[model samples]
Target chain A: MRDSLVAAAFELFLERGYEQTTVDDIVRTAGVGRRSFFRYFPSKEDVVFPDHEQSLADMTEFLAASADSDDPLVRVCEATRLVMRMYAANPTFSVQRYRLTREVTGLRTYELSVVWRYEKTLGDYLRTRYADRRDGTLRANVVAAAVVAAHNHTLRHWLRSGGEGDPLAEVDRALGFVRETLSPDAVPAGGGTAGEQEAEDVVVVITKRSTPMWRVVREVEASLGED
Target chain B: MRDSLVAAAFELFLERGYEQTTVDDIVRTAGVGRRSFFRYFPSKEDVVFPDHEQSLADMTEFLAASADSDDPLVRVCEATRLVMRMYAANPTFSVQRYRLTREVTGLRTYELSVVWRYEKTLGDYLRTRYADRRDGTLRANVVAAAVVAAHNHTLRHWLRSGGEGDPLAEVDRALGFVRETLSPDAVPAGGGTAGEQEAEDVVVVITKRSTPMWRVVREVEASLGED
Candidate 1:
């Protein structure tokens, strides 16, 4: 029934325009009463984004189920992938909604609010995970914003191409950046620069003068990771 | 005259609530004709955020003046500070607008669009600066969002505190994370762990046994820069 209403809403919205198409028109086309429409959707704007609430709920549940051992950065990347899947699940509807959203000022603002909710959810999960660090809250918020920005950049790229190609691959490449750059666990490979820290790293590899560079390189890595 | 229209609109919005107040009410309250009201602001929502247009223009101009020597990350932080200063310039008005925006969903969404413009401005600047990099667009968007998130987080903190405290200090503290973590020029100080690098940094010092440790450290630093 919800799907039917959404289909009807989009049909009327595309044909008669979003502002001109009333809830009454939607209910009439869907062959349902006003009560059914209200039961399913809170408002007209809600109909345009029928899947987000479920996707958001799924995201919250997914984040909530995260294990203590999980890397928060990787977990965030995984969580955002769920949103991409939701959009990918129904390309026709997703493309339609995206096009509709761009054309309407009110819907554009409404979409922003929805996007804000996703960022908040991501931020909340990360804040808890990073609670122990000195800049935990700030890092959580910045990383969350970064993840969203990366995801949206990729998603919009896909959408602009009319939802063609592998969005998952595109998004992964984008989120991979957040994990690589901002993840503390990923930092030691290069040191990790955000600002000032323990000064420049100084490693003294005391391999034999005849030792090959590769073996000396391996020894240096093993020693650095020990710290 | 423009200020008076905004002042009158806000006063009317506060007294009678945002939705109930009409443009006529604003014009009547300000003792200005309806034509004058339209000349200053296109709609009721515009009155709530009168300074953003000029501020945005200033921000764009500020960002456009970026030189090749400038660090894009730091430039973004400085650009966002302009917004912080604008809000700080008018405490009473800022507080009132913040409160009003919180109470009205419409205003909140409207504010989001204004924020989107700012983020876009920052992103466009960063994208151009990072155009030479592989993930230039992705990093630009991520850093842009991070800057705005940091700025908004600090601004809201100030607003929630009844607009007290040094907003500049709070924003700098927030944006400090972006500069520390995302800046490429800032990356060398930490070795940078974003991902796998040149295996590991192995610095071999073949100094005499009597050489000072500080001298060895300086030699290692000089060699590392050569890479």
Candidate 2:
């Protein structure tokens, strides 16, 4: 009945504008009673998207299954992918919902509110992971934000591109950038050496014993003068 | 008028619960007309906020002033500090606002929405600074989230502690963790020199010799095998 009501709402929403559609119109088209519509959705705007409560529950379950693992970062990536898959699973409905949401300000804010809820969940998970360290709280915030950003960046691109390409690939690429930035210390082979850290005066020399200290000192002095 | 309304709302909210307070009740207490209340605020929920619009505009001006400088990261730090100072300037109101927001679900969501707006502004500023890089978007997202997280962490701590300490120092400490995490390529002088990278391996060898050849490799490999 809920699914039928959602389908009817979207159909009416498309045939007429969202503003032109009402709860009575939705029930009339769905062949369901007014009580049924109210039972399924708190408001007309809610039928346009998936059940966020269910998705969040699924995410919580997924996280709970892997709570013993020390890798919070990897688990977050997987959790985000789980959400992407949910959207991808029903592409036609997702696309229709996205288009409808764009046309409604109230719906857009509602959508954003849902996204914020997801971010908070991720943030909470991360905060728990980093609870023991002095900088755990800060690290959790960055990691949570980065994970959500990567997901959203890919999701927006996918939506903007008419949902034509492989969204998971783009999500992976965005996540890769995040992983590298946060974990630059794990920089792999052949990616060139890591950049310098400019905290204090530090000199690095790549030379053999045949090179004299006086020449090195002269070079250092010259570099300092240039600076 | 807005100020008086806020004071009245807080007073009523404390005396009665948030759920018990209505716009009509607030206006009656403030001795303002309904038109006056509507002119100043969109809803009763908006009364407890410190001028978010004004703070957003101030942040915009702060970012605009740093357009020619190279240190955008530092500029954002100061902009965030401006927000913290505003909260600190009114400890009683902030503490009361916190208590009310915590108790009211609608107010809590509204507060999250406002914080998300702040994050958006910070992210947009960072994207401009990191525009030329491959990971600029991802970097901006992480950095922005980190700033908000750091600020929120300190803000919550202060609010919980009755706003008694120097939160500016907390912000700095949080920013330092963020900056270091985002760019982790620190090198120490006169310490162990870096070694060649491998896909599954990274070697940091401490040696007195200046030569780079089989002897060094043998020493490193022999010691590494022991581990």
Candidate 3:
């Protein structure tokens, strides 16, 4: 019945436009009463996105099942794959829905709320993992947002291309920024980490701009001597 | 007249509740007709966030004025301050609205759209700035989201605390993470970059993880010998 209702709703959304299609129109087209429609979906907007509730639960559980030893950043990155899988499960439906959402303002806002829920879930899990750190809450939130942003950008790129190719691979590359640049031992993109490194044995020498190479070598030797 | 409608709407929202309050009631309270209310705000949601349209324009203009040489990451971080300044401008009102949005699901979604717009603005500005790079669009969007996430986390902390203290200082500290960890020259936090020097000689040694300090020094000395 839920599937029928979603199908009926999408049919009407695609045919008559999302704004033009009413709940009564959807229920009537599905050959079900309005009460049955309400039983399945609280609002018309809810029908356009039937997979989020289950997907969110699945994502939350997946993160919960992760070990403490796993890198929280990587775990969160992996979790985004679950979302891609949900969309990939039915590329036809997902592509149609994506197109509908791009054209409909209400659906777009609804989509943002759904994405926010996923980000919040990731944030919550990371917060627990990084509880000991002083900026645990901040890092968790920022990383969660970054993961979602990357995931969405790549997912949208795929969707915009009519859902061709592997979204998972694209998403992995996108999420790598969160891991590579933001990781504790990150060697920043352009090399100099504006100023700090956490691990031992690695050395970053900071000098005034345009410093001579010979002087740079001297500085490295002097630092080595001190060590 | 616009100010009066906003004042009247917030007044009724606090007293009679947001859901229960209607457009008719707001117009009645403001001593104006419904048409006048719509003239100022397209919807009740617009009244709750009366400042965004103008604040966004100001932020866009600020970014538009940036020079080619300005660091784009830092520019985006600075752009977020305009948003913080908007919320900090009216602490009492901002705090009240924040409370109301937290309680109302509709308002929360509405707020999310508003936030999405700000993030989009930052992203658009960044996209133009980083257009020459291959991953420009991806970096632009991710950094924009990161800046907004950090800003909101700190802003909400202030709002949750009844909007007390210097939000600017708090936001600057929060935004520093984006600059420090994500910046091209950023030194990761902890030890290596902690001792930033103004010496004329600088070197960066990237080696295998867990490499011994002796090898790192030797490696540095070898590089100098080649030079």
| Better-scoring candidate (DockQ), 1 or 2 | 1
Clashing pairs in 3: A193-B185, A193-B186, A193-B187, A194-B185, A194-B186, A194-B187, A195-B187, A195-B193, A196-B187, A196-B193
Clashing pairs in 2: none
What TM-scores do the predictions have?
Answer: 0.84, 0.78, 0.85
RMSD of each: 7.1, 9.7, 5.8
lDDT of 2 by residue, B1-227 (tens): 88888888889999989999889999999998999988989887788784888898999888877865656677777788888878888888888888888888778778877887888898899898879865677667767876777788789888989877887787777766665555423222223454322222233233323434444445445434542
The reply for model 2, stretches above 4 Å from the true place, is A67-70, A184-227, B184-227
Kindly list the interface RMSD, in angstroms, of each predicted candidate in the order they appear: 11.2, 12.8, 6.8
Whole-model lDDT values for every prediction:
0.80, 0.70, 0.81
How many residue pairs clash per model?
7, 0, 10
lDDT of 1 at A74: 89
Q: Comparing candidate 2 with candidate 3, which one achieves the higher lDDT?
A: 3
Model 2 per-residue lDDT at B128:
89
lDDT of 1 by residue, A44-69 (tens): 99999998999999999999999999
Off by over 4 Å in 1: A185-227, B185-220, B223-227
TM-score between candidate 1 chain A and the true chain A: 0.83
